[model samples]
Target chain A: MTAKIALSDVHKSFGTKAVLRGVNLQVETGQSLVVIGGSGSGKSVMLKSILGLLTPDSGSIKIDGRETVGLARRGRADIDHQVGMLFQNGALFDSLPVWKNVAFRAIQNDGMNESDARDLAVDALKRVELGPELLDLSPAALSGGMHKRVGLARAIASKPEIIFFDEPTTGLDPIMTDVINHLIRNCVQELGSTTVTITHDMTSVRAIADKTALLYKGEIIWQGTTDELEGSDDPFLNQFINGLAHGPIEVEGQKLDSAASPIEAV
Target chain B: MTFLATIGTFFLAFFEQSGRLSVFVGQTLAAMLRPPIYFRIIGQQIIRIGYFSLPVVALTSFFTGGALAIQIYYGGNQFNSEAIVSSIVALGITRELGPVLGGLMVAGRVSAAIAAEIGTMRVTEQIDALTTLSTNPHKYLVAPRVIAATICMPVLALVADIIGIFGGFVVGTQSFGFNAAIYVQRTINFLSVDDVTSGLIKAAVFGFIIAIMGCYNGYYSKGGAQGVGRATTNAVVSASILILAANYLMTALLFSA
Candidate 1:
């Protein structure tokens, strides 16, 4: 299958600190790729680079074979219009109501009618299992789970060809996490959209990721299908997935007790 | 040697920051001229940055006008020249105090609010979210505030000019035993259209200054809450200083003859 999104030798750095040394990754059309990494492992940076929020220092990022790195506002805007992102914290506009927040891209970019946009927003929300009763509610009024649902609704509301979910289950409980994971799976299947998700939650990784990539210290050390992920023998992958502190993954260059309560196993 | 180096570094930082601010202003102006202007955001900002700032601006101008009248009278008492109070107050209110004082007061309120709100958005990734939605933050957020403040400032200054003159009038007639009709006539006669117009011009410029400073600081704010707090302070301080400095330059340019 042709690749919907492709990155080759992507490198980005801020000042002296290098975030992405050389991240070469490719997502096939209609594949869900989850990138799992530690706190400072450049997962967010990689996502931001693709979104054009942060420019890479070097390398090629191709969406449908068009090089996207360093694209100007107009050029990047055309790409952004076809892409939808669900931020780690929902990132809903507090100034707008739930409907307006969901229909933001439609009303703001396409100049769609407000009534029509709201109708579209309601349809998207319903797909996320949210009823029309929450349309008027503010983002702050919703619980963490509800917020993620609304965010999912907004992300898919525009019917984008590519959707990104950044740590979709960071703060949700187990049941809600499963709910979000299920929603993501259904959304991708229904739309047949290429999906990229960055998350550390193993349960989510299994539920959502068709293919899995492990990013550590600005490099994708291991990538394979979810079934293959279990049989992989990469030390970095083992330490991260099993929450082992003593593996090759050094914390700030200091070796810690491998037997200690592993950091952020969730 | 260390102190000398420190002084050199400080000057270099100052110039660098000033240069950055100049570029930011140019970008804001360019974005404003481009299409896809969000009229709704502009209206909301007008209410937030201009209309909401009315009470504070009015209060400061009123008090300053009355105080100016009192000070002018005291200074003129020695020469039995207190009659100049009405003329001078009207001139000062229309030409300088109206725009300058109004600008400063609004700068404190509007600049801080804009900085805090936008800075929060920046930290929370809402600004980046705007980009992902195909909306330029400059066009959607910054331009609207700048345009709203620019359009609203002259209007705010006009209101301040009237209220300030009235404050002076109240003090002159009631507090200083001046004839009300004579004071009103003198204020009307002494104040030329050019004087009010120049002040309004300054007001518009000041409005642009406030919005630019606020947006620049907030947009560039890093870190988290502490960074946002710093941006809020810098916005008020820089906008206030720029207003005072620009007022002097504009006054020289307008009335040098």
Candidate 2:
């Protein structure tokens, strides 16, 4: 089967610091692929590259077998229409009302009528369990969890072919995090869309991801199903998943071997 | 040799900055002429950048006109003639003070606002979101603002010129004990259509500077709140400087016979 997204040997760097040295990954159609990584592990960079937010230094990024790395603005825009992104911070347009934010793609890109767009936006919000009462309110009025829900509504509003979630559950409470994870899963299943989510949250990963890729130091170190992720005896995965102090994972450029008992996580 | 190298590096940096700004201007112009020009957004900006700015521009022109009348009266008294106050004040305001002060004031108000708003959008990744949603940020955001400001400045300057001339008339007739009919006649007779047109042209250019600087600085802003702050400051400073410089250049070009 043809992959929905194919990234091969993608290398991107900022000055001397190599963010994505050579990232190779493929996400199949209708599959939810969660990429787990530590801070600055190049997971966000990879996601941005796929979204065409950042062009790769050298490599191939194809959306449904078509090259996208150097695509023109029109070509990129054509691809962008099918892609929905829930940013790490929600990134809602503060100047716009909630309904407008949700209906942004519909109104701005598709030239849908405002009243019709608002109706569609309300419907999308309902899918995310958000009420229409909050539709007129600005994003500033919403709490963080509510903001995420609204951002989710905006993402899924147009029913795009591909969806991306960046650190979706980062700042939410445990219950809220679980809620979002389940919501993401439900949204993906309902749309039957390909998804690439970036997070280090194990609970979220286990809940939403059909397949998992562990990214460490700008490379995908492991790839398998969630069950395989849990069952694997790899010490690096063990340290990351269990939040252990001692492992093969490097902290502050110092390797803490799994055999050595570190005094503290720091 | 070290000093020469330092000078060389400065020139290189200057050229680099010029090149970047040129590219930005080209992109803005191209995006401006492209399809899907959002007239709704342009109208909204006209309200924000032009209509909302009327009060400040009008008030500034009025005060400047009053002060100019007073200054010309005193300066001309030494020559045993203060009758030129209405004529000189009308000329000064229309040809110089009206558009210049209006431009400077709008630069301070509108430029800073545009920068802060767009800079915040940049730091928040809303710009990227626009791209991902298949909307070009330049078309959706920058072009509307630039076009609105460019269209509004001449109108604002025309109003400023009238208000400024009236301010001089008020001060001349009321404060300086000049005859009302003569003051009005002297002001009207002394000013030509060229004077008003020239000021309006300068106003249009100043408007372009304000909007372009604001959009350019805001578009490239990075690194969160600190970056946004820097962009806002740069927009005002650059726009103000460019307004004054462009005013001088245009003045020399227009009226140097």
User: What is the DockQ score, from 0 to 1, of model 1?
Assistant: 0.90
lDDT of 2 at A99: 96
**Over all chains combined, what TM-score does candidate 1 have?**
0.96
Docking class of 1: high
For model 1, how does the per-residue alpha-carbon lDDT over A69-95 read when each residue is reduced to its tens digit? Answer: 888978777788889999999999989
TM-score of chain B of each: 0.96, 0.96
Across B56-126, the per-residue lDDT of candidate 2 in tens digits comes to 99999998999999999999999977999988988999899999999999999999999999999999999
Q: List pairs with backbone clashes in candidate 2.
A: none
Compute the lDDT for candidate 1.
Answer: 0.92
Residues A40-149, model 2: lDDT tens digits: 88899999999988989999999989999989778777788889999998999999999999999999777899899989989999989998999999999999999999
Checking candidate 1 for backbone clashes, the offending pairs are A246-A258
- Model 2, residue B183: distance off in Å is 1.2
Candidate 2: stretches off by over 4 Å: A252-266, B1-13
What are the per-residue Cα lDDT tens digits for candidate 1 across B83-182?
9998899889989999999999999999998999999999988998888998889999999999999999999999999889889888988899999999
Point out where model 1 deviates above 4 Å: A257-266, B4-12
